[model samples]
Target: MAKTQYYTATSIDGYIADANNSLDWLFEVDEGTANPFGEFFAGVGAFAMGATTYEWVLENDNLLEEPQNWHDMYGEVPCWVFTHRDLPPVPDANVFMISGDVRRVHEAMLVAAQGKNVWLAGGGDLVAQFAQQGLLDEIILGIAPAVLGEGTPLLRHKLHVDELILTGVREVGQFAYLTYAVGDVARMGRHLAAETATLLPVNF
Candidate 1:
């Protein structure tokens, strides 16, 4: 059973990227040596991201000029870029440009992931689309000690109290790592009413 998880780093104000859609601010913060990214990435057989995120990585890393660099980050792990336009592929990187029903892509991602987990690399809206389809299972965020008044949002869906369960939290230097298990929103209200719990903070 491969679970679909949205793993991302965000500003304290819930922005994944700055107004320019750049991560320069995020680079300023030190997330500490002991981070959970490595452990989580080890189980991700496949990842999917929106065009903006994919393009940003491709440009920032110079994947086209230094093609091999792409492998160093993601190896042979398959990557799906949800886009409507054609995009150039980086030499040997296992990347694909696709657009259509997210459910269909999710099924493909699961198959490609084998028994491993499916990672939802983000641009916010794309991940929300998955959440709405009930294809998203978990959310992991590393909250940096910074804020971008307006930028790329962390998530675009209206998930209420019962929609998430706080599974874990870790304070790593200036960053706060949080993990939440996503539940069925339709049945979430009922569950929360029974438990008498408040909704988790949507800071990031």
Candidate 2:
């Protein structure tokens, strides 16, 4: 089964980017000799991201000056950018600009994925929408050794132990990689409801 995964690197304090929305801290760390990025990309048939993340790639990678970089990174894989404002598309790059419910776009993404996994490459807000709607299946977080007092959060919603099961943990260089399988929201909601029923409220 193709899973919807959120693969991202974050600070020790759970921020994916700094206050300036920069990933300088992430770039400063050693990613190791392992081809995790390549391997993961191979399994990703499609990807989606928000406007900020899309623009970051456009500026940070200088995609305009070096259009080949976009091809080198994503190749022919289709990228969906969810944004309200108009954004320029990279020449020769397979990208679609869209807005509205993520659920509809998610369905389209799955079709494009062609049995491979769908990667949610995003700013936290976008990922939050997916997870909140019970669309996200897995989370692979590469936790860096450094901390950013405050910045963009890794997750904007509450995920209890029952909702997220730890599946794997590995330490690579200075980063601690954690993999978690998100539970079915319907099942988790029912379980939580049962637990709530068992609790007695005290009259204050």
Candidate 3:
């Protein structure tokens, strides 16, 4: 089964991005310290993000030109960008733009994932939509020390009760990274053996 996961950084107040949808706050990380997110980043097989995040990465950094070692690993992995407006494609072979129903985009992502993990690369609105539909399988958040008074929240809506289980936590400098696994929804179904056991009278 394909598991969908989100890897994002949040402010102390739980904002993932600023009002302008910028991640300027995230760039303040201590360069000397080891990154706690390396493990999670290594595990992702594919990345999915909204158009805005994709555009920001390309324009802000010469990311498209100067390829880093991270690209050596992530470059081969498919990057699906959700966009309504058409834009020039990334020069790399791994990046692709998708415009369609969110559900369809997700389905295509799963197919492309091919048993590998699918990463939700930020954009709370997109993440919320997947969570609402019970399609999101995991959430991994890196909480930065700074707080933004107002910005884009980590999640926009309430999910089903007991829907998440914390798997691990790591501290890197002033930031704390947390990982959660989505509870299984299919477990709610009753099996034939369980039904038969329920029907049988209790032994006196």
Candidate 1's error at 179, in angstroms?
A: 0.5
Candidate rank order under TM-score? 1, 2, 3
lDDT digits (tens) for residues 1-204 of candidate 2: 899999999998999999999988788898777767787899999999999999999999999889899999999999999999999899989999999999999999999999999999988899998998889998999889888999999978788878886778988877888998896843565577789988968678
Instruction: Report how far residue 197 has shifted in candidate 2, in Å.
Output: 26
Off-target runs (Cα >4 Å) in candidate 1 are 185-204
Q: Mark the regions of model 2 whose C-alpha exceeds 4 Å error after superposition.
A: 185-204
After TM-score superposition, what is the CA distance of residue 113 in candidate 2 from its true location, in Å?
0.4
Residue-level lDDT tens digits of model 3 in 34-89? 85556666666777888777777777765657546337546577888888888666
What TM-score would candidate 1 get against the native? 0.89
Which pairs clash in model 1? none
Query: Which residue runs of candidate 3 sit more than 4 Å off their true CA positions?
Result: 64-73, 183-204
Tell me how many residue pairs clash in candidate 2. Answer: 0
Candidates in order have lDDT scores of: 0.89, 0.90, 0.75
Q: Candidate 2: give the clashing pairs.
A: none
